[model samples]
Target: MPEPIPSFAALGSHPLHPMLIHFPVAALLGLVASDLGYVLSGDPFWARAGLWLAGVGAFGGWLASGLGLIDLIAVRRIRCLMTAWCHAVLAMMMLSLASLNWLQRYLAAEPILPWGLYLSLLTALLILLTAWLGSRLVYEHAVGVEAKE
Candidate 1:
């Protein structure tokens, strides 16, 4: 009569996964801006945050995507299944790259700035595509047509 407990990876991929996702997104973006400021305005704080934010965001994004995939697989509907699959496919790549970039940032510190920027830019593009389709699933299909509901 009781429901089975969900896995951590599944929990990471939930619809509301974005809620937990924003932190790293903002942090990463802010980091980019911070570095840009350092380059243009000579203020180092922004640049420092950029380095710090990348690692933090990488962790958050990694966690959120992990849980999200779990929920996506549990869905029985095809549309949601496919859309979630697409998101998972792209996100997996971004997460891996971002994680690597973050690790590189940690090791090389300021000198590795470009790595984080490039990774974030790529991840941002993928997230934009995934987000657009995901919005369609939620708005048109109503909770993603992939669900049994």
Candidate 2:
């Protein structure tokens, strides 16, 4: 079996992935709500808010993914390696979607574009699946968690 990852990537023995994940998760999920608000109220504020949230969420996702990469390397020998790859791929996809959403919003002349709103809603669904895979990595597969002595 491969050796475990060093403790540096963790926070006092806890996984960094879990700790840093909240920001992107919240930001991305919040995007759907904000987009919904724009859709229902036709308010530009919600669109602007969604744009900012998308940027923040994409950035935060990459940051978290960097730490997750470390964990992935550490757990390469585990049986759930394929699941990890799926998680990583979906995460990067989610980030790409969010980044593109932000770009569309930033470049558009209109207050809110229908395609951008629809894309964000799709991104929200991807976030849900990606988050579920992350949870599976920790709970079912014990990817980043240290074994109990």
Candidate 3:
């Protein structure tokens, strides 16, 4: 078996990128739910909730991505993995969509309509794809996994 790749962007032995990713993933996925809630119930509360979720998701995703990028750049073994590249690309796409979604809601007086909902849905889908690729890196390639003695 190949040797494990350690995370350069780590707090001691814990990878910062993986640790920080969960909040943004949850927030982005929750944004879709909020959008659907608004669509079904026509509630302004859901729209407002979606606004916060999008903002948090986009911002938090960037922060986590930065750490991941650091590891990708610093670790030659990680850079050699196709799964890491795909995960990075998909994550960038998802973050872009999330930023646009948040911007739409922030600028428009009445948000969470056809465009906001659509963007939310698209971003959510990308999140799933990106997450899958990331999981493959960890579980299959053992990126960031420490070797046992």
Best by lDDT: 3
Q: Give model 1 RMSD, 1 decimal.
A: 5.9
**Candidate 3's residue-wise lDDT over 26-100, tens digit each?**
999999899999999999899989999999999999999999999999999999998999999999999999999
Candidate 1 residues 1-149, lDDT tens each? 12222233333434456556677667656656665676677666765666677778789888877656655666455223465567677777767776776777667756335665676677667667766765654555454222432
Using TM-score as the measure, name the better of candidate 1 and candidate 3. 3
Judged by lDDT against the true structure, how good is candidate 2?
A: 0.78
The residue-level lDDT of candidate 3 at 83 comes to 90
Alpha-carbon deviation at 2 in model 3, angstroms: 3.3
Model 2: lowest-lDDT 10 consecutive positions: 1-10
Off by over 4 Å in 1: 1-15, 78-80, 144-149
- Where model 2 places Cα greater than 4 Å from the true spot, the runs are 1-8, 78-80
Which pairs clash in the backbone of model 2? none
Higher TM-score: candidate 2 or 3? 3
Clashes of each: 12, 0, 0
Q: With candidate 3 superimposed using the best TM-score fit, by how many Å does residue 82's alpha carbon deviate from the native?
A: 1.2
What range of 10 consecutive residues in model 3 has the weakest lDDT sum? Answer: 1-10
State which candidate has the highest TM-score.
3
